[model samples]
Target: MTTGRPPRSPSPSSSPDPFQVKRSSVARLPPSTIATSYPSSGHEASVYAGNRSITPTSTPSLSVSSSTSSDDTVLDESDDHDLHTALTSEQISSTIRNEFGYCANQNYRCVSQHNPEKPVAEDEIEEPPYYILFTTYLSYLLVIVFGHLRDLIGKRFAKSSFTHLMPYDGYAPLNSDFDSFYTRRLKQRIDDCFSQPIASVAGRTILVYDRYSEDFNRTQIYTGTTTRALNVASYNYLGFAQSHGGCADAVEESIKRYGVSTCGTRLEGGTCDLHRIAEALVARFVGTEDALISSMGFATNSTVIPALVSKGCLIISDEHNHASIRTGARQSGAHVRMFKHNDMRSLEVLLREVISQGQPKTHRSWRKILVIVEGLYSMEGTMVNLPKIIELKRKYKFYLFVDEAHSIGALGPHGRGVTDYFNISPSSIDVLMGTFTKSFGAAGGYIAGAKPLIDSLRMRGYCGPYAEGGAPCVLTQIIASMASIMGVSSDLVLPTSTSTPISESSVNEVLMPSVADERPLPSKVPASALPAWLSLPPLLSDGSEAYERIRRLAFNSRYLHAGLKKLGFIIYGHPFSPIVPLLIFNPGKMPMFARMMRKLKPTPVAVVVVAYPATPLVTSRVRFCLSASHTKEDIDVVLRACDELGDLMDLKHGRGERWPIEEIVTRSVELVHSI
Candidate 1:
């Protein structure tokens, strides 16, 4: 049989016959064989037999090799199966030009166009210089190798010594000597134990773990093998923080439609239909003519307060009003005077003093006097005596600004905040500010009040001109939460008894009653005492889920408070308030107790430890916020753990023992003055 071999050319020379075939004396190879040998320079072209194809794998190297004579050219067989495949002459030429830097126009010639002895001009070069190419590859190599090494080391440290690196005992030293002492110590030693994973939602419970069980599951059952503990450290007062309900659904839908941000200030292009709707709903919910929403809850006060009261005004603020209010008061340049927290008598004293003193040095009557108080004090877990404050405001002719950040969705039968809870008129509040972050399952805040006040804010407030507006998704969440509170079918109507317009004469008459009088001014008016006209039923029926959630929250608060008190723990706040504070007087023991509580058996309870700066240094405490989502069983588990841990750490108070409230307040004042 005749093999398929090409016929030999007539002459060896004669323009060096391009199609000449040469066969070796060795065994004939298959047509699929590909030449393996090539020149050292990148210009070498690949050779294939028959119709086998070659494809370019990467950008061709720019360096060229010296040319070879036709007689000296040789090909070697390659074992690479990919090179054995058939290819057309066009593909071969393209591959040679693309991957081997061969000149296809010169019939796959591997010759350098530029002289090696002379430097090529930048205009003549197609590729980067050799030094530049070398540095680029070096950088990529270093990044890849070092990145992998870093990941490996990080993972090892995180799983091992990282968990125990900074103990709570070391934290006190760091806090005390941050600038002078701790700064020079080992950097890792200064890290706080609770620095990682700031408890955002905490779900139903928080997860706590130590070095031994760092990789434990969040829902791990208590077999004492793992350190994972349940969480109760967050401020999800109504269990709305991490809820996956209508509000969440609305937020998702709004995100799809409006994106993540407005990218503009409220007065520019930031305001949306959802924002307007949310503002209207908030105004109606708070029984106000209008409302203004701010992108940040804190900024609502920091910005609005400055706009409302200026140099000519006087601000009579509660001692324990939120830091946001204090910041706003300072920024306002108003004459500020603080009364003892929740102390109505002290407030009256301040009001009388401020009224008598008038403007400082000027000795002139103040243009305006605004009284700022919170519906619920965050650290103290106490509710403001709104009725008494309103009585005082009416008597003293001062505007009342109530920050209901923690109380809006946490208190009252319908979560209408302190005004509704105390059976006081919402109109009595001059500027009712509340945040959506706590109970409404979203961010941003609102300042709801008379139409003129809101209108004034819209025109003159700094936030309107300078700050970005709330995200559309946030507005959707607010609307969804308000809808849930008011129900779909019913309008939110304030109870007639509380809605009565407050008059100076009426408040005087109410406060005139004495302890010995047959009818003393009611400390808190019960729903039963309301006249028939003022005793309208809630929009949601008693059987409704919304009503039940509020009821369950109230029940959980009482249950947890009583349980902790029974365990000999000194508790703070009204029994009805959802926030419960357990006094841990020893600063050193506060973090220790929190860490130990997280290591409890059966289930761990996650509680937030509040220390100096947030609270009095001598009165550091652990705060537990109850939620409607928590079951009776969940409450019981936490209580049981607290009882056991309290005893173990000797943190339990003596029976009927309490922190002297007056003494603590006095010391706190003194400390503040000294500072």
Candidate 2:
């Protein structure tokens, strides 16, 4: 060999280069959009979608034809998960084996670009990732096993339910013809510990641990022999809702001000000054000229969707739209349509069809073709392509309404939200909606957009608490204080005008355009506290560390993700998200696993189990959360538990064999084909 020569390149040895990626698919995608016609630099795409090759268009391209009535047959054994669409092809498009599961760039070179000759074994390429393989394979396992799994789970619960039918050893059924024993008897029966142990609080050990001390060095109020164990079985998508405490203070203040109730529907007695202030904060947060507040994120979506739509409107919704949107669309009274989730091309096809069909429902109702979307889909924790959606909106002349209930505070820089996350103008989104419970940690919601839209709602359909007596005094203080606390200028209230249209263009230049600044608007006065919508209490954000940590949550989430992934377990959420779901497929194992996690450490954690009613039966998962209070060590403990449980499940399921890549790969591919 030449002295110091770039060590003579290894021959094409017997060991196949893991770095050599082979795209076995019959087709290839262009490096850029198909419409752009930019040639790729020989980088193969493991990323697959049925011809997502082109950029998004205004017309709907995906034909919403049924695959087959037989394939769509409801499994008789499958219980009512309610979320029947969880298993849709639209939701489970990518696999870990498929490209995005491991690396951020699905098209990055596997080996050192400089040394093409020295490649690692193809099997050694950790690029595709193990989790993706696991999930893809698991999904396949679900397809083959969901019905059986559903029956097994149902049978377990069913057998457990019939404790009443069982013959009690002592005093069981009371056939004594005395009706007097009803109330007393009922109380005794209700108190009877007849039920089977649903799950063990301690998987293998009854641990005496303190979660607060272990995780945060703070007080964990729930622990020990007499711990208040609440079944948070419905807690879905990890615990992003409870991770932040700023929401608790905001909720308290809101109650003090708004008086714990909208009192009625927003259109009835519910709309209050409290409601308006809530909407205004949201409007500022989302960068819109107008906004509305509602009881829930679901309502924000359902209400706005139909109000903006009419009989002739055509909607090109992501096939995987959250249930609320689906209900809204179905009830919209407009011509409803759908596209593949995140499929720009499918949306184009639908949009084109609607446009070609042409002529709005008698233009008397301002051509109302509205594009609706959810910020962070609750289950998958996936994101919509906002940039593409905006483009389609502009091109198709459709109004865009984005529900940011899940996107606020958890995504994007400074949590300006999904619009901000995409680096797109918040102005492009015709409507923005969010819930207070997630990022804000409050218990309400708001919608934002142009003043005319709200004005129209107010005149024809508007009704709020103002219709009753007045907004509660406490809500005003909370709004003022919250606005102050959130660092919002006091004059959040826009001038009320029922007679004339609010001039937005003139308003933006003269008044504070975005709600982000600390300076007061021309009309706004300094309030005692910031608005509760900001959710930061006076005592809380005042601390330098509190503010710093609040700002760095996303970084913490990323760190936690890296840690957990290294331990070999699944974590759910979009890229760069604080939310994580430590997924476990077995519904039965959930409660048991939670107890295991709690007992495994010095402090037992009750990781919530998201089951049937929250997610589909096929989507049951254990949601593990990360808190700002968590230190690096805390995350590692959680990660270890996740790994242990995952390993346990894989080992116990079949011949104690590990979940092999070859098996997962072939299974996942087969599942994809069958779908």
Candidate 3:
């Protein structure tokens, strides 16, 4: 199975050879020498790092399916998985919103233990710019070290493998190595991409989304300001963040029982029955025999990573894997190698290297191997090629850990995720990790697989040792039961079942909006409705609570997608689901684009700005998430705005309201009142 660079996008392959790629994107990826060259003159830096992307030939194509008169019908259950996944991501992304940001702002007033050296705003004194930069840099560095420390500590413990960076830090100008440079570069690249806003003393904002929103509604999140000229972005898939019943319910429950702080680790007071139950239910839902719950999906990866690989072990990872996996792999004292995204050939090359090292007994020290991948690549909105990778796992004898954070309820014939989507036996995978936060519309992550494997990881994984509490328990149990229902209900839970990707006909039959098929449509169900299948009535009733509302949302999403696309926006996620990412070029254009969107519609969407660190510069886009709350009329307002913009941009049709607004104002007499 040749899975290296993504397959050429339908027609011609634009993928240059590896050497060429190395010269362009991957090469500049600071080698161990960045310590010698920390960009001191941030002021003199390139106004733009320049958005760039190196899409593999094997990456999935963004093929659009247009509707004709005859195609109106219920989309098949198979495509329902993505709608669920899309909605889930949308829900999470949306949660990063204003109220959350407001809460974060409020929390800032509290005293801080870590940074006791506080800078009071006496006489409105802003710290010197250089000092601020230094503080910010130190903060970034701390995050990098803390985030990747597991790798550093692992190497030291192994003696034969790991290299300690702390000791090297004091060496010369700095302990410059591939590891150091890599970690630094990761932070630098991300920070540089989202250059801190130029506001003099803007409020530090952190959107505090109602954590429970992941179930059925998306929470809209805003990181900076409503006024921050729009170049920044978020993951809002369904826009459920602003308001959603499931999200509200979950947040209410979490605050009520957990009361904000565990004060200690899960093993300490943190390990409530709530965390334990969630862990078990999540494990089963994701098709794993067992699971370990974590504070976050990322923490799950961070902890499980180094715990699994050791001394003579090796880790084969995808080039495009999330930073969490990379961090974990680094901590694992094993030799780490990377394959191109979805590229089986690159993985094979690394596998061969490991196996070819020596004879069996002699090579026993480095015998173990773990292959890790995200169920769905965040930027590409594509899935891991499971079948191709699984073959390698079977042949080479390597443990597989899939980060199904993005795809748990998004893919597979049954919404069982990538593994189930590909029809691989559940036990074939050594470990499975997912988040109840996403698909279930709540917050918390889990790791499931063989019970022994999970148990061992919990007791030994890096964070496991430090964790006091596991995950939220009550939520996970409910999630598990929902997953159980998904297995049986093709119309809502997972897809019916598929050996390959869902067929186009199935998609049209289930997702398309048409009166021809009054039956339940796949596209219209509130992704939150997936787990709510148990709660659904046997007969689909008109205007009922769960099912009735879900259908409306599905219809709204499609209507919104159609309206937005009509205005020349490249829609992502899908109308069937709720995520709609708008395609754009220059990062500079994003803010203006978002503002334009807001002004144009009666109830305009706050477009999320996306650029480099989060996605390739070339892939700069604005995500426009829709929801069940939206009305067909609301979609019309958006479309009319698009029509106006289309005309401004010289598009074929000018999108605008056919009617005009009437306004009245008086200026003469009121002008002098204040004076």
Candidate 4:
């Protein structure tokens, strides 16, 4: 954390040979590469991949393959001819443009590292036009009034419908009118906008099943039609949600070998060799002493937090934290307090008050205190002020817990999570929790910390004894994706005996690289710790593919964030954040915005629009989750769509310098770099 801004790298314009797309014939990456030995500190063995060193900063040149398939016709049919030509035949055949859009222009990629010399930008929430506010409130007022009226009439006149809301037999109704009001009235109106069914991989594009509600959304009937739409709705951050890729291939092998499940809880013989491998990799990835895996992301917090603190302990949490954090705090029986989201001053003030006041009515020393905050706020798109929080933690002496569910693999230069993004040591935070669902395209979560903390949770936390263990397929996906991010070392030896259980001590025995500034985590995965059967493609094994994914996601996130701001829309969150929330003030516009985007001609785009309950009523918004699988042209389509719809819907109300959609699309690379 140095003062002032770090000088910017030389501008793209300054290069004599600025990024140019050149037509070239390159050798396709062989299915299996020669294993290159990596210098290791321990016993070494032959690696699966070859010794060829690939440039991590630039996109590798891939050419036509010897074989082609009918599925490869999508490349020829794609509108992005330049990209189609640039991709190798193997890539073209394996990747459907609709599933994973390809982009070869290196200028559109940037590293997501923070410059200590530069001050973090203020993430102030912008107010919309006064008229927008008035209309939004009025809209909610009318809806509430009408909703009550409908309930009044329906309860008396529609006795059949009221049967469920009224007492039936000895048992009271499962849901009373008062309890079911919101879901029955307001949510039903926009039901079609949410829970959209899809038929394909939720990658760059999704096959949304077409359906309509004939009975006012009480029920939906399928039309047996599917529409392909550009996807900005899913949590596929680094674009690993693919059917064909190195990760997918590894997963298939895992499934064939281990079937689907471990069949029981960890303590009940559910744990497998894969779990040990994944936990070790996760610990290494996040630069922690050790890690514990959970079957569900939400459960990871809800179950583990209770084990950490209880009764007299105080949990200071961000007001905008996810539901799981709140659940965990409540279940922990800890005295919960809140600070305004990402407001360091408010947090410090609260910290002082709580410290002075002590536990409620006791006026005595508290047992322990934990400050819980999300690395990235899912709903608001704001990031926790980690650097400031770290500084405060030193003074306040409160244990810190960062929920990086949405930040890991999506933020930071090496996709190592928030600690990496802020250039802070992972050891600074007491606990680091993250999920594989968002960035890894897998289904579980992990809790990482000192070996003792994880070991304690394994015994005290409910998940380890009651919940089912991580599935073999899911663990394989995590291992493959994580290893790709942390390239596998060729000189590492594979464990000889499958019967030999891997313990924390054995994993910790792997050599820890010398700690260096800006290099907090190990650069490569200790292939010796991985299962011998798992094999990764050369690009994946070399780390170039994952590096590209990280940089591409960074570029997409910045371009979208900046593009919307320049379009005169009041967007929330850090510029580097992938979750971009565009305020649509009026609740009526939520469904309208979602529908308009989905119905865009030529190529429909799917977006997630959230309203009351998710956010403040007036801040009903459409959240765009950018992914690495998306091409520049895909983002151009989104920007253009937003520009057109924002005008028609009267949603652009920010007081900022504006740019036309054309400029935003044409100068996207420059715009991304500027941010």
Candidate 5:
């Protein structure tokens, strides 16, 4: 936990010598007078000016030294009172120096004047520089003046005068009116205050933004004009999104052998050795009999859902499920029923109601029922209660489908998926779907389950012949990444399951362990103790190093979460997860908060600001994605910047009360005009 730096010591040049005191400047009082005026209480001391008590801000120290004789010294109350009253400020400061070894300041002035060259203590410093004060005052004045002007303008103009100039109201612009309304109003508003969206790639310690300038020719693509910035937006969880190492080397070799594109679907001549290897690895990793790979992560769910479920079936889904799943469910022509997000009780209630009521219009039992959920909710960063869901599945006779897009290779002891995290057999899940774009550092997705189900999809699925298969290079990257994560080389043989296809009647028997008995497995192993074949030389090096990366990532996430919470930020999700959401409850301040974060000094932390449609109107937030590549120092810097910005903008929760959008927009527009 130590930062590897030594503790700072006080400089000798700043401290004054107490023993070298000037006795001539101090006033002496009569001992008889002091004896009559001092109190009898040894510990309790008080000073009085006439009838009123004049208490010192701090307790004064008393030193008694008798000049009569060294042997005749009196350390009594009377001597203590005489010493306290007779000593000047400088003498008292000298006494303090002698005791505490530091100069003490009182009443906005230094008591000890022994060292004139030394700088004044921070407590004695003046206000901020003149320029800061002037600008602050000017800004306040402008707001007041411009606010009145906006009010006047509104009163002078009728409703129709500015109707066309105003932007759309509510969460999003109406689709029919968007072109006319947004082009003339919203576009201008954004252009005035926001920069154009630019693209970038991950580099060492920063994101490299590609830009065009006058120095480069118009047709030249390699102008190389770039700006480096701190990356906080990307989801490169395992730190595998690099130009070098095992993943890159594999990609290079695959490209040289097979060229760039597959040019056909998996059913045609597009099935290469890399594709077969990747699919086998995925099937083994998830503990399933088979898996089907696709070129696109989104299309995997969109195309496969319809192939499995259709019109006579019922699909019960979580309300906050991803768009791809929702789209696929709609296309399947099944009766879709949505339950509240992560609310197990709500889901149970719906199941009970549906079972009692039967199919719509016809009081007959439903043909088939399927329950779908995600391993991790992307927006809220919360995990689904898999054990509870499995229990519900058994009781209700419903098939379960878990999308491990966020949880695979990021959760569990072996990075297998959520099933491993809960110590449940993968056969318990009817269908396990996941994307390689996140943890695997590749572009593709897979649907793993029993061999029969996969074979059905390969033959009847729409994506088999119409959609292009994954590129040879991308397949190689996926295979290498999976092997490295499992602590094995490409040639190493792994343990595989020989279980038959999972059927509705055999669900309970196949998943032998009861839901009540299931528990989580250890999520990490010591990096140094891993097998030699798993070591990827320069990149992963050893198992200990790999373990350290995951550990450091979790630690950094918790550190940042605690810091943001301390600053009054309403954070979402559990402390263990790396995805942190800094909630901005006031919808109007979401854009302002994002702009402030980008303007932070030293280096800008790139955060994705999610708003309405993605989240509820008032629950918008800035999402921070932590990675193994980030250091503790990077986390600390971000925390400090966010704290300062939150306070300055009064955006922190429970600090400033929420204001109406009209008031906020009015002020913003006024400020913009004034600027």
Candidate 6:
């Protein structure tokens, strides 16, 4: 079957590097090079330089201190050589921009913190035109009707293929038609749009492999080509997914010293000093008393939640919480209940019902009532009403578990998640769960809470004695990234100014104590919490770069969300959320949207489309995960493509005021702040 439009032609360059992506055709973006100048301080810069040059001995010492300039940090010399060689002569004269895009405009930046004085009124979800909805229903109906007819004929005429789907010789069928219909029929029709392989870093731009389907997507034939596409599909939220950077450099150095695996579980001799150090940094980052790290992000919830509640305990969860949360809740064997997504009233009603009615049948009081919520919903992009939840928690005294998987490093001026965004004390929430995979560009998850609670979970949780500890490199990524966000303690105080790309005033606005006369010191990464051997550049070490990332992500997220709305496309979620979901009400439009966006002119774009099980049948959408690595110009490219395609596909059915795509692109800074 035809995948869509013919794939874009490959780059003219015949360079051997498989992962190098073509630069954008819309406009040439400036290179985003990290500044290498060291800050003048009492600490010697040579110390960090020495640390980066050390070779791993048979037994490495724990107290080694090292450092290096950004110019010298190279993970692979050949990779860099190949990358430069692949570029044209004109491009070779200038710096080859890394995956991280550059934008120095301070006007685009916005503080994500919520001001209680100005409560946010949720934007009403725009409805598509009636004709669009009517046609959408018709499309699904025809597909289902034709699918059943085809299956009937296939079973009657093609018995050999149907044998596994039906009982044969006293053996039960492998799968009934009812069980596999969606996967075998409806989903199979559009399978090519789902998992297209990519060859580059999942940053602002990605190199997507070009392919075509031979047997209705049963098999795909790679054309031995790739199209460089603007990436609005990945979860590299703060854009730490780079091949070259302070974080990457530190990770490479750590691999040399620690040699990857810790060799065992946390409780069975697998634990390293890095584990303890990372946990300490995590606890401090989230403002929790203590924390425990798990090897996998999914297992962090799936395994530990059972230890938190069971049997008579009640688990009140949001209807749209991640599957991992649901899996953990099921394993806990708790009496589970769900409230409407982000509906505080529904939550309150459910809390009252559970508190008043107690356990079902016996009517005995529940052993414990834990309310679980996501800091940001992945599909919908809505944030939990944290302030109101705190209000309910005070009234009902239920323990709260907030999963900050997407929000930890994406939200707030300080990048501290929902609690920071709303200016609520982290201590107010009973449990804080977050993953390193999303923003830190690492491979683990962490659960932070009271020291006693964490200590208890570490010993009793399912992951304690069985799961392998996080790899040393993964831990190094976490430590380096986290420390970058939480700058190292220093006497150098850069004066606050409005002209600065990331101003101290903006940081102060988010980090300001809720109470007057109770000034809290900024949460700086302790020098001792990091591996002594780890070497970071001045910007990463000082936390300036991370602050820029936080602001840039905030800008990109707001820009895309606002720009799409301006172009008259129905969308869902908060303006500040990185995950922007544009509603594709008609099922037929889902694949078309993906195809058009990917095959868009000059620069192809990668996007993720969701339907059915991930969302309601009617509300299929294309999710755009914005990143700090994207510049304003990158967002303009996306907006322009959406505008052109939206016109072609009749997707611009959104109501209210609309702006021309050109105007939206020009006035982006105003639009972001307005939103």
Task: Write down the lDDT that model 2 would get.
Answer: 0.43
Best-fitting candidate, scored by TM-score: 4
In candidate 3, what are the lDDT values of residues 1-675, reduced to their tens digit?
221223223234432211112211111111111011122222110111112121234432110000001111111112122233434432322322221111111111111011224321111111223443354456547645764674566656754333343454455423544556543434333332232233211111122111122322223223433232111133222222322233333334444444565531133433554444444345445544446767666788877777776656667788878888888877767778787767667788887876666323564434456788887666544456666677787677667888887666544334456665455556666677876543344456777765556546766775666865533333433443233323223443323455244322232122212212222213223222222212222221111222222333344445554455444444444223344555554433444565576443224333455655676534456654443333343344545555565455432222332222111012211211211
Clash pairs (backbone) in predicted model 6: 48-66, 48-67, 48-68, 49-67, 49-68, 51-66
What is candidate 2's CA lDDT for residue 461? Answer: 27
Give the per-residue lDDT digits (tens) of candidate 2, residues 401-511: 787777765565445567656656676666677765554434455666556555454443222222332233333332433343234333324433332333322322222
The digit string of per-residue lDDT tens for model 1 on 449-540 reads 75556656776678777887788777767765565566553222223357544332222122222212123112222221111111111221
Query: Can you tell me which runs of candidate 3 are displaced by over 4 Å?
Result: 1-260, 263-270, 357-365, 412-414, 470-582, 624-675
Model 6: per-residue Cα lDDT over 533-553, one tens digit each: 666777677777787788878
Ranking by TM-score: 4, 6, 5, 1, 2, 3
Please give the lDDT score for candidate 4: 0.77
How many collisions per candidate? 12, 39, 73, 9, 3, 6
lDDT per prediction? Answer: 0.56, 0.43, 0.43, 0.77, 0.55, 0.74
At residue 260, candidate 5 shows an lDDT of 89
- What are the models' TM-scores? 0.60, 0.54, 0.50, 0.85, 0.62, 0.82
Ranking by lDDT: 4, 6, 1, 5, 3, 2
Q: Kindly list the per-residue Cα lDDT of model 5 for residues 275-349, writing each as its tens digit.
A: 655665676567665588998988989998887777766799999899999999999898899998878889999
Q: What is the model-wide C-alpha lDDT for candidate 3?
A: 0.43
Per-residue C-alpha lDDT of model 4 across residues 434-496, encoded as one tens digit per residue: 999999999989998766567667877888888988888898899988898899876543233
What is the clash tally of candidate 5? 3
Root-mean-square deviation of every model: 36.6, 23.8, 23.2, 12.6, 29.7, 15.3
Clashing pairs for model 4 are 4-117, 5-117, 5-118, 34-49, 34-50, 35-49, 35-50, 36-50, 38-491
